[model samples]
Target: MSWRTPADALRNELIELFLNHPTESLSGETISEHFHISRTAIWKHLEHLESLGFVFDAAPRRGYRLLSTPDILFEPLLQPHLSTHSLGRSVLYRPVIDSTNRWAMELAEHGAPHGTVASAKEQSAGKGRRGRMWASPEGGLWMTLVLTKPIPLSRAGELTLLAGVAAAQSLRTLTGLDIRIKWPNDLLLNGRKLCGILAEIRAEAETVHTAVLGIGLNLTVAREDVPALLQETMISLSPSTSSPWTKARVAGAILSALEPLYDSLCQDAAGFSGVRSEWIALCAHMQRTITVRLGEQVVTGTCVDIDERGTLTIEVEGKRVQVPSGEIVRTEVW
Candidate 1:
């Protein structure tokens, strides 16, 4: 809902009252006197809330009781649960957009502050690494976080890796699933792709002024809804777990998990060593044999370590090779 007018603000206030007393019935006269609006205005506001997927039970003497709220990623629904000082404190939400990354970049160009979050319910042109299109359906979390810090361009790769680690850690803790981070920018659940991270930065003179970290997580997408090519590889979260994780909850958890790590890296780039250790512990390819395709070269080796710079180390034919950037074509245990 566009909160540009006083009526919208009053409507939000009314919803908050119902949310605060979910089990108890609130009389319309009480709400009307509380908000200084007429009982007729209360009915009108409830209708507007109903259109937004809020279920209210109204009776003769007993007023209105909220039964359920929509799981959409609206600012009102998400703002109450956020505990971070920076990230997600100011949220801009859209029902449909071309890409959250694009929107975030635009905001950054206009001097949006650090830790501002832009999210969309559906993305028409969601981005993936290497200029690929990410399928951002309705039942997924598509958001971008804007970082307006002066991070050196050389160490920009750490953001994506740390983001993967944050997602894996938060999802595992929230859902009780074994979420693993594939080196570089992928999250895997049960050996299948569950989420992807794409980080874009605007840099000049070897320093980045603005970087947008875009994360796409499939939460409740169905199998058939997935593209045919990705059907065998991609997976969603809700179907695999018994917990009822709303999009707001997942989004809040990820931002909360990432804020401290991001702040540490921003304060001291050398602190990446500690974050690197955390990442390696969660790395899905560590100590496993994998084949990575770097342009024209395909290197198959056993993954050994990931350095502070977010480069992968592989043991190939008794020699250690550093893979600065590449895609893992295949993975095998032992």
Candidate 2:
């Protein structure tokens, strides 16, 4: 459960009205008359918006003026920009949570609908691939999408790749930065990590009951916000020269790109092949000599291709080695 109240709906409408007239001041009398509510109710809603980081300027005669809006991923701010059919239709936002993925998995088990999204401003126990800990803090996008439909266990890897493709494309379009996907589940920017994706499955026997896809991006993260150990290896998405990209806009873009690809993969088998090609195109280490660490075992090889099943095929020694799961610990070019 979300903490949404009946008042949020009216507040969302009020937000829209202010957004439409961004420069003009909205008089309390006009707002109350438009919403058919009392002046005190409008003031309360405005106060709530202020608490959520919306700054307002009020005058005796001129009324309230929208000074600035925060970069937070509030659902109402994102809803108007979203163009997806199902993905992110219902978003559960938390100021702080253990993990969006953890909460989303619990919701999926309890029959949460497909395309339900969970997000948080900060995550205490955020996850990464292969049980690694992700650094999730304020000024970042920590989110999860729950898929309620059952899927075959074999296609789990492809789902992660699909998410990578969606994120890479969206970031490139939104920021015009050269965002690349490293094999497995990392997004790189300027040879440094900018985002990570982790896909978890809840299943009984061999059938996957639910697939939870979590993404964490370093958008608007300051140097002090990142852990000291990862400062050198990670990069943040800074605002472009043209305009600042808000967390809500970035979230909406990624979700919009993901929903159709997800539907295509679940509905059509051939869609995985297309996703594989896109992943390869956006891949950061294709055809490069790299060393992968599989626990105690390590293998060095040239990245060849990603198969339809999302296996990273490497040319090691004289033959092709299929790596189903491993960490690319070292890259030659990056």
Candidate 3:
């Protein structure tokens, strides 16, 4: 069994105490007595929490009060709420990283166990499909799930679709938002991009050795902080609804929703069929005209259906053409 450090356990307890009384100040003596720790230890623990971005207000006689909670994916705050079997069994959290996907890939290559998760507060070099740079500022969900189980290489595409489904379902359950999956690996809210999924796999011949599924979700990004080029195309989740959401809460929900789907995909082929059906039902572009860009070629057609292998089938020139992968340039609704 994995054990938490004494300091970490104390920190969590302190956080819970603060959370239980967000508006009230708790005296140092009270906190120390409650936890059965020395006043100096409480001070040290508070300092450590401050270092993790938690804000506290202190006065000579008024004791200490939590000013604000950090917008970080702290494991202590997330683990209690997480209801997943394996997806987030071993989480590696970093304050900042070049890319969670890159880090997860390195760990997988070095024998990281399956269901390990790598998450970061911010990613300096996040990437999307077609080698496009993804803006991963603070207050967004940037994480990667490492899958070590061996499966057919052809099933890799389906796994990517499954990640999209998990994210969409999780958001819908949390906020009651109208979330929809866009083709292979994107979740859209009211026709705007809310989340992006990228799946990378390493395979020999037809067998897969490992796969890393990376997801970037915009939870609380400010409108001004968004890049000017993507202001209209991209959106954050907080602005659309009045419901308050924390980064750790949303992250836990995503993991909880993904765990069962991951188990089904690895254990039963029939389970993948159900995933595909749900994906199709949640797809935003079905029967809609879309332009897909493949290298130098662009095909404009009406999206008819997605096949068993998760290939998009679009009707072009009275014929249905299956597009294994491509960039969707535009979607036109009838």
Using lDDT as the measure, the top candidate is: 1
lDDT of 3 by residue, 173-242 (tens): 8999999998778899888889999999899998778899999999887767767887787888988889
Candidate 2, which segments miss by more than 4 Å at Cα?
1-14, 17-45, 57-67, 109-112, 239-242
Worst 10 residues of 1 by lDDT: 1-10
**Per-residue C-alpha lDDT of model 1 across residues 178-230, encoded as one tens digit per residue:** 88988789999888889999999999998888899999999988878878999
Q: What is the C-alpha lDDT profile of model 2 across 1-334, one tens digit per residue?
A: 5334467557767877888899999899999899999999899989988987899999998899888877776666788768998787766667789998999888776666788788888999999877878989897899999987666776767888888999999999987888999988899998999999999987788677788999999887776777899989988897523567788889999999988778777764655687777888898899999999878999999999888888888999989998988899999877
How large is the C-alpha RMSD of every model relative to the true structure? 3.4, 2.9, 4.2
Best candidate, TM-score = 2
Q: Where is model 1 more than 4 Å wrong at Cα?
A: 1-49, 56-67, 269-271
TM-score of 2: 0.86
Please rank every candidate by TM-score, starting with the best: 2, 1, 3
Measured with C-alpha atoms, the lDDT of residue 245 in candidate 3 is 89
2 versus 3: better lDDT goes to = 2
Superposed Cα deviation of residue 52, candidate 1 (Å): 3.6
Q: Which ten residues in a row have the lowest lDDT in candidate 2?
A: 1-10
The count of residue-pair clashes in candidate 1 stands at 0
Cα lDDT of candidate 1 equals: 0.85
